[model samples]
Target: MFPPGFFDRADPSPDHFFYAPPRLVTHIDDQAIAAVGVLYQELGMTGEVLDLMSSWISHFTDPPERLVALGMNQVELAANPQAHEWLIHDLNHTPRLPFDDNSFDAVTCCVSVDYLTQPIEVFTDVARVLRPGGLFVVTFSNRCFPTKAIRGWLYSDDASHLEIVKRYFEAADGWAEPVTKQCIPPGIPGDPLYAVYATAL
Candidate 1:
C-alpha cells in the first residue's frame, strides 16, 4: 500500500546504535498515557501479554498476569517495572519474533510503530505468536524521532497513520477486521493518542 521509499528513514544506521542510550522519558503526555492505559483495560488485556517495542514504561495502569517486553535496548527493557520478563531484540533487523505460536494473549506497541521498517513482517509474526482471538493493539501519537521514523509516517497526518496501521493488519492476513479509534478526545492538550487494533484469527 506504500511506495518504494515509504519505509526509508533519514538515519539509515543500525537501530541498536540509535537506541543505545536508555531514554526513560515518556513520549506522550500524562493524559495520553492515561488514555492508553484505559484502552488496555477496556480491551481486557489479561493473561500473557507481550509489550512489543517497549521502553522504560509499558504505560499499563494494572498490568496483566504475565508481561514480557521485547525491545531494542536492554537497559530500557530492564527498567520497565511492569515487565515480568524482558528480551533485547530489534524488529527492524529481525521481523520474525522469537516466541512460540499462541504464546501471548495480547500484544501492544505504543508510540513505537513509526520506527518499524518491516512492519508487515512484524505484524504477521505478531499474529503467529498470539493465541486465537487475542488482541494486537497498536497505539501511536504525532510525536516521533524524525530521523528514525519512516518517511511515510513523517509525511502523513494522524488519520493516515491510523489507516497505515489498519492496512498493516489487513496485509498480515491473520487478523480480524481492524478497529480504529481516537483514544484521546479532540481539543485536549498534549499529544493526541490513537489506536488501531484487531483480534488474531
Candidate 2:
C-alpha cells in the first residue's frame, strides 16, 4: 500500500486551473529528448501508439500509424504533428480511458508521470488499452512543477521515483516484469532522464 499523503500535491488546487492555459514549451532538453527517442526506437514502439499525458512533441522520430496523443491541454495536443488524433482528457478526474480494450501496441508517457494523483488506476487503464505484448513506457526527468507533483514524487529522489513507477505497474494486472533504466544520454550535462516500462501480458 502507498503511504499517507502519497498523491497529495503542495498546491491542492484544481488541475484544470493550472492547465487551462496551454504551455507549448519542451520540458526536457534536446539531448534528453533524443535519448527518449532512442529508447522508443530500441523498444520498437510501432503501430497504434498512445501518448498519455502528452504535449506538443512526442519525440518520436518515425511516427506510428495511429498515434493518439491524449493530454489536458487542447492547444498542446493540437500542435502535435505526430498525433493522428489528439484528445483532451483529465486522468485525475477520470482514470478510465475512452478506448476499447486492447486498442494499442504501445503507450508512452514522457516526462510527465509525477503529476498523476491516481497512478495505479491510470496504469490499470493503460493495461486495458494495451494489446498483449504492448509496451507501457513511463519516463520522467528530475524536473517538475513541485507544487503540481504528487507528494510521493516531490519527496523522493530519482531512484525512488523509479521504484514508485515500478510499484504502479505491479499494482495493476496484465503486466510483465517492469524495466527501469536511465535514458540520460552519456556525456550530456543536462536534465537526468529515467524510465520504468513493462509489457502487457
Candidate 3:
C-alpha cells in the first residue's frame, strides 16, 4: 500500500470545478499522440473499449468498434469523434464504474491515472469489467495539471511512475503479468510517453 497522504493532491478543490470549463485540448504533443496510437495498435484494441478519465482526444488513431468515454467534463467527451458514448463521473469521489461485469474487451485510462485517489478500487473495477483475456492499458506522458496530480506521481520519476501503475495491477485480481513499454523512442523532443498493460487472467 502507498504511504499515508500519498494520494493527496496539492489543490484540494473539487475536480469538477477545474474540469467544468471543458477544455478540448490534447495533453501531449503530436509525436506522443502517435506513440500512444502505436501502443494501442500493438495491444490490438479492436473490440469494445472504455476510455476512463478520457478527454476530447483519445489518441487512438485506429478507432475501436465501440468506444465509450468517461470523464469529468461532458463537452470534452462530446467532442470526441471516436467515442460512441460518454459519461460524466469523478473517479476520485466514486471509484465504482457504472458498467456491467465483463462488459468490455479493453479498458484504457489515458494520461489521467495520476488523478485517481482510489486506484486499487478503480483497478479492481477495471478488471471486473474486462472479459477473460481482455486487457487494461494505461498510458501517460510527462505533462499534467500539477494541482490535480497526486503527491505520489508529482514526486516520482518516469521509472517510479511505471512501478506505481504496475503495483496497481498487482493489487487487483484477474490480471496477467503487466507489460511495460516506452511508446516514444528515447531522446524525443516531445513528451516522453510510457504505458503499463495487463490482460485478464
Candidate 4:
C-alpha cells in the first residue's frame, strides 16, 4: 500500500495527450532488450499472450502463437510485427480489461509499469483475464518518461522499484508468490533490467 499522493504524476494531463504522438524508440539498450527476450523464453511464454501497455516492439525473439497488444498509441501498436492483434486502450483511464476471463496464457508489461496510476486494479484485471497458473511478467528498466511516471516510482530507486511491483501483485491478491530477478547483470550494461513476475491463482 502507498500514501495518498503516491500515484500522482508531475504531468496531470490525460494520458492520451501524453502518448498521442507515436514514439517508436526502444527504451532500453540492446543488452537489456535481449535479456527481456531471454526471460520470456526461459518462462515458456507461448500460446495466447497479452502485451499490456505495449509499443512498437514486443521484443520477443520467438513470438507466441497469438500475441495481442494493448496500449494508448494505435500507430505504435500497429507497427508491432510480432503482434497478431492490437488495440488502443488506456489502462490508467480504465483499469478493466476488455477480454474475457481466462483468455490469455501469459501477460507481459515491458518497461512501462511505472506509468500505471491504477496498477492494482489493472493487475487484478490481468489476473482475471489469465487462466489459472498463467504467468504475468512485468519487466522494466531505469528509463521512463519522468513526467508521466507515478510519484512513488519517480522517487524510488531500483531495489525499491522491485518491491513496489511485488507489492502490486500482493495487493491485487490473485497471484501466487511473486519472483523478482535482475535480468541484466549488474555493472556491465547500458541500462539494468529487472523483473517481477507471478502466476495467476
Q: After superposition, how far is residue 34 of candidate 4 from its true place, in Å?
A: 0.4
99-185: candidate 4 lDDT, tens digit per residue: 999999999999999999999999999999999999999999999999999999999999999999999999996899999998875
lDDT of 1 at 59: 89
**Candidate 2 structure, TM-score to reference:** 0.97
What lDDT, from 0 to 1, does candidate 1 have? 0.94
Per-residue lDDT over 147-175 for candidate 3, one digit per residue giving the tens place of the 0 to 100 score: 99999999998989999999999998778
lDDT of 3: 0.90
Instruction: Report every candidate's CA lDDT.
Output: 0.94, 0.91, 0.90, 0.95
Residue pairs with backbone overlap in model 1: none
* TM-scores for candidates 1 onward, in order: 0.98, 0.97, 0.97, 0.98
TM-score of 3: 0.97
**Number of backbone collisions per candidate, in order?**
0, 0, 0, 0
CA deviation > 4 Å runs, candidate 1: none
**After best superposition, candidate 1 residue 45: deviation in angstroms?**
0.3
Query: All predictions: root-mean-square deviation over Cα?
Result: 0.8, 1.3, 1.0, 0.7
The 10 consecutive residues of candidate 3 with the worst lDDT sum are 181-190
Q: Once model 1 is optimally superposed onto the true structure by TM-score, how far is the C-alpha of residue 174 displaced, in angstroms?
A: 0.6
